[model samples]
Target: MAAVRVEVSVLPDSVLLQILALLPPWDRLRAAGVCRRWRRLALDRAVWKHVDLSQRRLSSGSLWQLLRRVLPAGLSTLRARGCLLSASRQRLLSPALLSALGKRCPQLRCLALSETDLRRIPYASVPASLTALELRRCELPISWFHPMAPSGTLRRLLLHHVPAFADWHLMAASCQHPLRVLSLRGTHRVTEAGLLQAAPQLKGLRHLELWGCGAGDATMGAIGSHMKQLRVLEVVDCPVSSAGLGPLKSLQGLERLCLELGEKVAPKAVIALAQALPRLRELQIVGACSGMDEIRLSLSHCSCSHSPQAPD
Candidate 1:
C-alpha cells in the first residue's frame, strides 16, 4: 500500500486551537514548541481564558515566563493549587511578579490558590479587578485582610482550612469588602459572636456557607435577621440546632439549603425548615437524627436529598 500523509497544518486555526485546548496545560505548552504557527494558535486568548495549574509544581521563573510570554491579558480564571511559590529564601510570587501579573492580565477575575503559602504576600498585591478569590490551607499573614483597597467588584470569597482565620479577620474582611458570596470552612477561631457581628456587615451576601466553625443558633439568627438577600445557605458541622435554623424562614429568597448537622440537630427541625422555606429548590440534610426518615416522608413532594453522609 502507498504511504499516506495528513497535514495537520492545513486545519483551520479555530479547529487547531480547539484541539490544543483539549490538551493538558503541560501538553499544550509542549505542542506550542512544535512550530511558530502552532505556538501562535496555542496562545489564543480563548484557549487560555481559564488556566488550571493545580497539578503543576509551578516555580517563580516558570510563573514569570507564563505571565510574560504565555498568558494573555484576556485570561479570566487562574487556579494554582499547591504551587511552589518559593524555594529557600526566594519567593516565587514576588510583589513585582504579582504587580506584573495584574498589569499583564487586567481581565483576570477568579484566582484560586490552595495549599500555597501566602504569608509573605500582601492582600494589596492581589489583582484589583478580581471578582472571586478562593484560598484553602494557605498560611496567611496576621494582617492579610487589613489595608485592603475598597473593591466594589470583588464578590465571592472562599476560605477553607485556614487555621489562622480568626474573628478579627472575618470582621475586617466583612467590613472592608462588599462580599456577595462568602464560604468559611474549618475556621474554628470564628466564634458565634464574631459571626453575629459580621452578619450585619454582610447584609449584601447572597450565598453563605459555614462549615467546621463555632457558629451556633445565635449566629444563624443573626444571618436570618441581617442577610435576608441570601439565596443559598450551607451549614456543615456547626453548633446550630433547629432553634437557630428557625430564623432562616425569613430568607424568602432562599433556593438551596444544605444542612450537615451533628447528632444534636433534630429531624423535626429539618422538616420545619423544609416546610417554612417553600422557595427551596434543593434541600440536603445529612447526619440528622432518626427523624430524618419522617422528615423525608413529610416533604416527599419537595426536591431533597437525605443521606447519612455528607457529600464531599
Candidate 2:
C-alpha cells in the first residue's frame, strides 16, 4: 500500500484564538479539555469572551468547572445570549458559576440572555463597563433594576416579555445613562407617561422598539420630540397613528420603520406612512393595513404556504 500522507497547516496562537472564538459554546468547552497546547490556546482571555450558555444544557457543576478552567478571573467580556429554560427546570443555575461569571467577566458587554429563568440567577452588581444588555424573556423581580448607580457608558438595552415594573418610577429614575439603542417589547405594564418621562433623558438614543407596548400617541409624540437623532423605530402592535410618525419626518437619520396597522386601517393611511418616513430602507406592516396591495398579496400567498402567521 502507498504511504497515505496528510499535510496540514499548524495554526499559530493568534489564528487559533480566532478559530476558537468563532466556535459554539459546547465545542469551545470541549476543545479546552484537549492537550496542554490546545488547552492553553483555548483558555486565552479573548477565547471565552462571547460565552453562549443558552438552552441551559450544561449542568451547574460542569459550567463551573469549565469556567474555572477556560474563563479565568482576567476575562473581561461574556455574552450569554439566548439562554433558555423549560418551565419545569426554571431555577437550575448553581451559585458557583454565577459567582465566577460575575467576578471574572466584570467588563461583560452585549449580554443577551433571552427567554431564560433569571429569578435565582444571582444578579451581580453589574460592572460599569457593561454596555449592551438584552433581557428579552426573563421576568426578573423589581429589585433587579433598583440600583440607581449610573452607567455613563452603557449604550444598547432590550427588555422583552419581562414582568411589569411595579415601581416604574424607580426603574426609569435608575436609568441615568445615555442610551443609543433601546427596546421595550411586550411591557404591558409600562404606561405612556412613565416612558415619556424617561425618553428625553436618553438623549443619545437613536434606535427604539416598542413592540406590543401599551403606550398611546401622546407618548409616541413625546419620544419623537426628544429623540431627534432617531434612526430606526419599531412600534409593533402599538396604536401609534399617522400623526405619531408624522413628526419622524424631521428625523434626518431615519432608516427603518415597522408597524402593525391592525384590522381597519384605510388605504390612504398606508400611503401616508410611506410618505412620512420617506427614507425608510425597510418597512414591515402586519394586520389589515390597506394600500399595500402587492405586499398583501405576496404575504397572503406566503402565509398560506406555511402556517398563515410568521413561524415562531
Candidate 3:
C-alpha cells in the first residue's frame, strides 16, 4: 500500500480556521508558525473575538507588544488584569495602551479590567461600541469616565470597590447615556446628595443594585423617585428606612424587589415595601427566602462593617 500523505497545509482556509479556533490562544499562535496558511487562518478576526489575558503573568511591555500583534480589529469582548503597574505610571500608560486597543478593536463591546488605574484613560480613546464595562478594585478619581460615545449605546456598567465613583460620575453617565443596569458594590463614599442627584436622571434604568452601602434616605429616595422604569432593585445591608421606602409606591413598573436589613432595623420598612410592591415576583428579607414564586434574593452576609472592602 502506498503511504498516505495528509497535509493540513493543503486544507481549506475555513477548515483550518475551525481547527485553530479549538486551540488555546497560546497554542494557536504556535500552530500559526507551522505554515503561512495556518498563520493566515489564526489571525482571522473570528478566531480572536474574545481575548482574556488574566491568566498570563504579563508585564506592560509584553502586553503592549501582544496588543500590537495578536489583537484583531473586530474583537468584541476582552478581560485583562494581572499586569502590576505602579499608580503613577498606570495613569499615564494605561489610557494610551487602552486607546490603542480600542482603535484596533473598533467593534469591542465589553471591557472588564481589575487592579488598574483607569483615571488617565483619555475620554476620546474609549470605544464607542462598548455596551458593558466593569471596573473592580481600581484606584480612580471621581467621575473618571464620561460619555465618549453617542447617545443610547452604553447600557450596563458595574463599579465594584471604586472609591472615586460619586454622584457626579453617576450623573455624568446618566446624562450622557441611557443606562439600563447599574451595580454599585462596596462603593461607600457616595453621600446622600450624590445619590439623590444622580438617581432620578436614569430615565432608562431598569435594574439597580446597591450592596454594603450605609447611605440611608438619600440612596433609597433617589431610586424611589427617579428610577421610574426600574424593574429589579436590590438593597443589601443598607440602612434604608420606612421613610425611604415611602417612595416605593410611585414605582408602578417595579416587578422584583430584594431587601435585606441587619438586626438593627425595625420591621417597618419591610412591611412598607411588601405593601407597596404588590407586583413583585421575587422578594428577599434579611437573607431569607420569603417569596412564593421563583425568586432570586441572594444576600451577602455582611456583618457590622462591610463597605469599601478591599478586593482579594
Error of 1 at 222 (Å): 0.6
lDDT by residue (174-275, candidate 2, tens digit) is 375567888777777777767776766766678988766666677667766877777887776665566665665656567776666545556565555455
Please provide, for model 3 over 183-250, each residue's C-alpha lDDT reduced to its tens digit, 9 standing for 90 to 100.
Answer: 88888876667677777667678998887654676677667777888888878767455576777777
Residue 47 local lDDT, model 1: 86
Q: Per-residue lDDT for 1-312 in model 1, tens only?
A: 999897898989988988887777788888888999988888778889889887866666778888887888999998886543556344446667788888999999999987777877877898888999898887788887773546446799999998989898898888888899999999989998889888889999999999888888888889889999999999888746768878988998899988876567777877787788878888887665577567768886477777676567
- Scored against the true structure, residue 243 in model 3 reaches a CA lDDT of 71
Off by over 4 Å in 2: 1-14, 58-63, 72-77, 81-102, 115-124, 166-174, 276-278, 294-312
Find the candidate with the highest lDDT and give its number: 1
Worst window of 10 by summed lDDT in candidate 2: 301-310
Off by over 4 Å in 3: 1-24, 31-41, 82-93, 146-152, 262-279, 287-312
Candidate 3 has what TM-score?
A: 0.74
In model 1, pairs of residues that clash are: 85-92
What's the best-to-worst order under TM-score?
Answer: 1, 2, 3
- Evaluation by TM-score, superior candidate among 1 and 3: 1
